[model samples]
Target chain A: MNLRKLFAGAAVAAVALPVIAVSAPAGELTIPSLVYRTGPYAPNGIPFANGYADYWNLLNERDGGIEGSKINLIECETAYNTQQGVECYESTKGEGAGALVYQPLSTGITYQLIPKASADKIPVFSMGYGRTSAANGKVFEWIFNFPATYWDGATAIVQYIGDREGGMDKLKGKKLALVYHNSAYGKEPIRTLEVMAEKYGYELMLLPVDHPGQEQKATWLQVRRERPDWVMMWGWGVMNQVAIKEAASIRYPMDRFIGVWWSASENDVLPAGAGADGYLAAAVHAPGADFPVHADILKHLYDKNKGAGERDRVGEVLYNRGLAAAMWTSEAIRTAMKMHNTKDPTAAQVRDGFENLKVSEARLKELGLEGFTYGIEISCANHSGPGRAAIQQWDAKAKKWSIVSKFYDRMPEITGPLIEADSSAYAKENNITARSCN
Target chain B: MGGEFLFFIETTISGLMAGVMYALVALGFVLIFKASGIFNFAQGVLALFAGLTLVGLMEKFGLPPWAAIIATVGVMIVLAWLIERLVLQYLVNQDPIILFMSTIGLAYVLEGLGDIMWGSDVKVLEIGIPQGAVDWLLDDYGLYIEKLEIVAAVTGAIMVTGLAVFFNKTRIGRALRAVADDHQAALSVGISLRTIWVIVWSVSGIVALVAGVMWGSKSGVQFSLSLIALKALPVLILGGFTSIPGAIVGGLIIGVGEKWAEIYIGSLVGGAIENWFAYVLALGFLLFRPQGLFGERIIERV
Candidate 1:
């Protein structure tokens, strides 16, 4: 309590002040993906998320850690809740993040974040399923729905059905019902389908399922009565499984059933077992653990006890999808870096990578997505790059996916005028000149 | 019309499942009301907290699901005793409205505590409850049901049956009834008022656990279970505070009745009639039977 004690106390107080004032470290590049891995929609959400994170982690561990700078993924699980998704977005936005390119797997979350992204200048690359109008990129400069929108998926669905029915000329008198989850995501494809229905002469039925995707008995009961020739599903999570099971219960032909990329996954089919086998679903990416990249992952990280999940799920459907999502997001980062030639490139640099990016078919096959992914390209005016997808089918006996349809390109009859009008609308709205393909 | 009819019936089944869930929550309210004559509005949040505890214990702490379930119920018992001692003990003779308000505050406290503990991720409850649909009568429409609902229904029934038998037959149950009837008399008759209050609340805690598990298992455990408890308030009105059998009957009627209304009448009003049906039914019941279906009738004496 005397002279020596006073000096010790003063020393302790002096040491505490600097420690309190010290700011957090800024070296790590944090990316927050608001993906729902658990919830009613988890079956559909988990795989893409796992794959996305897997690809990111793999690049970190395998590829000299993302341009030799370590990346820290601050995970905030939203369980597909809109408010939780926003909260996750807000909380992680301020942590010295190099670039904030959120992949909010839910369309509703995407809609909520669009304005925020513009204010923050953060990029929102919603690989698939966002506002089709946002594809213009002028009004939504910070938003990038690369690959294809649901509208494109819708055209592809109708187109695939047409090809199955002989050709586009044989589409008349064909009845295709659009059974969609009753949300922004589920409803995205309907307007496009409506437009295509007028040209194709196929009657379209729109069925809306309530949230959580559990109860669809009544929705399918109508399918039994009217008996549509083909059904396009826009569902997520439990809704995906319930839709398939109900379709089975109604004795609807499994081959005629088509789900969007989100609606098809191992979780969706495994719960209902082999009854949903042969159910066709649209794919924006390849599936399986047998891909060369996945094999490398297993041999390296997994074999060395550093894999993210069960080794058995290495090339599983959702796991691969999640890995693909992460791959594209990281590749975009790589693209941005290669363009700028700097490790500390900002969000603007990342956007430039998105705007002037290319991932061709040859490069994809070389990357061991071999026959899986269709090549993609991006430009300023058109953010939804390459715009190609092949249909994938679940072979229940094999317990794996097999590519069914060849790369079905977008018909200009469907995308042409819509693109023109959208371009004009975007040009007028943003008060900017539209970019031309010189 | 035929399709819409099936849709209505299907909605009715969902509504009933929802209603059965509501009744399980309402059971906690009925327990407190019958034992202490105080409406515990915190029942919903308490159920949520209990469910969160169970999930945390199982998923995070690595306990087996069955062990977690047992441990969670044990925690609820201790929580009930602590609440009776620390919170409700001082408010014994307070105005009923003030006591009710205390419960409302407790509800907020419980919800905040749950958020702090569990971090608000909606967890898919896997208590091994069945999720498939059941069909009777040519499997077309009428009574098709999800197996989860049936488990909830049976669980609620067992809870109600257990409570009824306990109160009507057991020594402690008689002591509880005596306390509810006349606290002064019960005190004079050598029943410990504190002990009796503790037992009733602990019993109510068990009820909360049961309801919490079934509801959480059905709708993915989250803080949203608190909102489900709000549905139980009107349920108390229809069942009468002093009645156990009344609580069960009232909950069933509300559940099945709302389903019917939403299905038949909802189609005419663009299909959200289920939201307001309970209140409308309450209004009609209030006009015809103001004391509730089995609630005690009051007479003007002044």
Candidate 2:
């Protein structure tokens, strides 16, 4: 019923947002996307890439593309396979490109593409799931995983759990179970959990659920018997719903289940409905259909028959994440173009564009993204431009997810040394010389 | 002694619920292996698809609970018929291994098809199966059980009993038995092979629907339903591919045994026991009785 209303509303007062076309008088600023829109993992990729394409299209229509230069985006479907990802990269990276920046979305692709991207003067933006050590801009100049790395999130989750247990001391001897997808994404957080276990004296149990996570009888039974005080989920798509239901079936306290941002959504919760009340997920963006951007999307793009989805669901968790990614990348391109002679620039020029990038608090306020993020500032030393995250809990009463804790401070002291060691190890393993900060 | 003992007892009962779910997927494996000599690697995927269908109908189409369930069952029956006519019919008399490979391919096809039909996102299935708990006993300590888990156990038992009766008494069941014994012999006796194959696949599809509902309700349906099917291989080995009762007993044992091992021995061995529990059990059982508990023993007379 609500879906119908949203669709109806969209069909009403929506004028299409003008797109910014790339002048492309000579060479084009090519942004290649290796997306998996039709696969097992499609649930996560479709919305993200759809939002990405929409953003690029909006730029083309609104501002004649970035820097008054039209942006040409070539999407090569890889179906989330690394080999296919490389194939896409190889095929798409050579077409009159300027400031080559790739967001592979898959960590494996990120790892495989990093060397080539760096060699080709392209920058890889791995928002959350790539090499944590790349947080050090000195070692990995071309790779950028902005905002929050998995390690950063792991620490943030640990801190939230500790606070809920009364204090850091309360975490002593507590059981923290990791119900994770058996993939690179899930494995990213375990090292941090192990570190936390040693420092906090909490018992950490690792449960690896195979991809898509719907059948977890053995794992959940362990949860029932072992009774892990808390379960931290690092699953995506259908896996999230499965873990939550399994937890509910065993009558495990829902409050104790903490899903990583990717694992929590309307998609995850709607299926479980009332059964999934009281669960928690770490969110980096505000979740609601009420944001102005959502409203604008409905009134402008969707209503005009130009949006990717029904107009009403504009500010959904995933839609917002998609919007955020598009907005951030576009803003970076805008900034890059602004710096490059205020005209068409090369991919190398975009590198100079992202090098000293700044999205101040004032700009965030102007953009209505103030509370969604603290501030995004990218520099040579810091690839995770913004270092902040917040916790949101599912409230059955409201039938909505609500934010509970403000952004908790991450311990840079602990993370810094780990970053150094990681960079060193990465350099050694990959057989690349460590680029010194000097 | 009392409090800790009560805790221990409560955990075990909870552990049994876990056993029931394992048995659910295992029953799916047994169904296919008994009638059709194929392992049906697509069992887990079938469950995932069925579960996705139920949740999709309710959330997307606004189908009422009873209607969605009836429709899902009807859909599964159709799916069974389709498999028999389309894939199985073509692959008749092929190597069993080749048949297994086809199902593996079928697994991929089902997975891709499910994603396209249902957009890529995990859905919450609140069919409202029971949530509270049924009170039971542990003397000083009360043992509580999830109403959902109870439903799963009872449903499984009922399904198994109905299957046993159907096989022993029904005409089609006799035809299935004759086909299982010797395909050519059954064909010569005038039993329609096409009809028998359709019946077998349809029955297997129905079993998938049951497993789908139980596992989907318990875990929330997703593509991961296929992973649960893989775990059933060991269960099938222990229960024997030809025995229904073996699937049941084997499921309970795998589910409960894995839980107990993970808890009691996890601490001793860095705490991961569920990973290899079923295989170890199957190995030990194979050494003593290779044909499995309920499987007929083959004796060669030279």
Candidate 3:
């Protein structure tokens, strides 16, 4: 209780607090993993989370971390809730020299973080999902949705349908129904699809299925009533399985029915049993763990009993998507390190690396990912890369997906104007000046 | 018949079938409510637990569908007994709201326990129930109805009949009704309220299993199976919380009304309104008939 003793204790405590609470030591890279491993979406979320974590761990184990610096992964569970996602971002953004980048797996979370992460100078990689107009990097300078956007997926689907009917001209007067989850994520493709419908002269029917879509009998019955020539789905979680089952039960030709990349996963198709055969979906990467990177992951992680998920699940669709996300982020990190000549690059340096990212086919081969996915090139002007994807068909009996067609090039003629219009409006509303890439 | 009329009939039939599924879940709620006057919020989680257990048994131990169902039934019965002993016994004379709040807690506990016991993954539940559309209906009448929906309807009818008989005729059932009527009086009359609670919960557990199977067959067993309870909430509100028969009738009305509204009126409003249409109809019924169609009106002295 003496004043001298209290002052001594206070001085000791003040010194200890900073020592204990200091963010990760120098030369360690901090990556925040906003994951949803429990909840209704956990079925889809768990595999992706595992794959993402395991890939980062693989780099640490195989190469002694990215350029021998080691990675500090701060995994905070979001449970797929936007509010929780923001909390996770706030809590972990300042850890380990600051978060180099954020890969928010949920579109809702991505939209919420776009401005927040941008203002914080932290790059957000939504990767295939999120605000599609973030592809216009001039407006969304810190957000990157490379490989493809929902708009690209929509156009690719329509292009595939056009090719199937022999030509784009054959799509005239055809009825295309979109059974989508009634959320921001699902509504992203509506404008793009509507524009494509007008261009191709097809009738676009919109059927929105509410959240946690379990009772879809009414929606499917309407499908039978209208008998649209093609049904395209933009669904996730339980909605995907239910839609596929209902579509199968109605004996809708599974081949004619296609789903966006989010809807195409083993978890989505296997639930419907044999009926999900011949189902088609858009894919940014090839399915299966036969790629060399998977072998390295198995040897370095699973073989050492350090794998994040069940070993058998490593090659699944969502797992591969997660691994791909990690791979791309790590490459950007490497690019940042090289650009700055430091193993520990800051968030701004990482954002610059993302802007100048280039993963050519030869580099993909060097990374043991040859044929796993197509090449990606990012620039200050074009953050969306090629926005290319191939069509994959689910073989129910074999219980696998195979690439059935070549990657479809982006329909710039359709998406370019739409992105400009949407991004410009976004810039105007938010009072954000478009950054000049040049 | 005209195409529009035929379509209407088809939609009505489909609605009724869909109602049967909702009623299946509501039946569990009614069973618990009829016995303990507690609306078991964990009923849907119980169904999800049952489905997860059945699939877990099949995948882990290499059991066939029949063996898995039998094993899952035992697990559910044990779970019901545990809930009665560990949870309900402590809150025997507590307010109904307290008991209801306890079940909400129990829902989270059971949900987390199910996840721990059998990992949270989408499981395919193929217990040999026929799926896809009925060919004869499609070929003969140009109507599309699922074989699985027919199976669900038939199973529901049998379950309702069996439950009705059990509640009206059996000695344990009379004891259950007495306990529900007056717990203290039934205890004074040598009726073991604890025993009745165990039996009622066990029976409800079985009903939950049946519902789990039907829904799991439809959409693959996952966490969303628990959210199907949301669909049953309006059904419980419309069909008195205490009446089994009301569950079926209320379910049919809500199902048909929602489907018809979605198809006929939803298009004009940009669709996806079926999720809320059932609740709106139930709200209207709440305004007109607070006691519901088949629910008993109690006379209490002030």
Best by lDDT: 3
Give the Cα-based TM-score of candidate 1 against the true structure. 0.76
Candidate 2 vs candidate 3: which has greater DockQ?
Answer: 3
What TM-score, over all chains together, does every model reach? Answer: 0.76, 0.87, 0.96
Best by DockQ: 3
lDDT (C-alpha, whole model) for all candidates: 0.74, 0.75, 0.93
DockQ of each: 0.14, 0.33, 0.79
TM-score of chain B alone in model 3: 0.98
What would the per-residue lDDT of candidate 1 be over residues A87-175, giving only the tens digit for each residue? 98987776564444788877888888877876798888877767676677655677888788887888888889999999987989989
Q: Residues B90-118, candidate 2: write the lDDT tens digits.
A: 88788899889988988888888787787
- Ranking of models by DockQ: 3, 2, 1
Better of 1 and 2 by TM-score: 2
Model 2 agreement with the true structure over A1-438: per-residue lDDT tens digits: 999999887766353221123223454567887788855566667777776776676667655777667778778898787999999888777654343678888888988987888889887877766787788888787888877787788888899999889998999989999988887788888888888888889999898776556445557756765788899999887778767766776678888899888877766766666668989888777777665555555555666788766555556677677777767776777777778765666666666666667877678766556666667788878887665678888866666777788886666765767888888887788787766552
Error of 1 at A240 (Å): 4.2
Query: What TM-score does chain B alone reach in each candidate, compared with the true chain B?
Result: 0.91, 0.93, 0.98
Q: Where does candidate 3 clash, by residue pair? A: none
Q: Candidate 1 chain B — worst ten consecutive residues by lDDT sum?
A: B135-144
Better of 1 and 3 by DockQ: 3
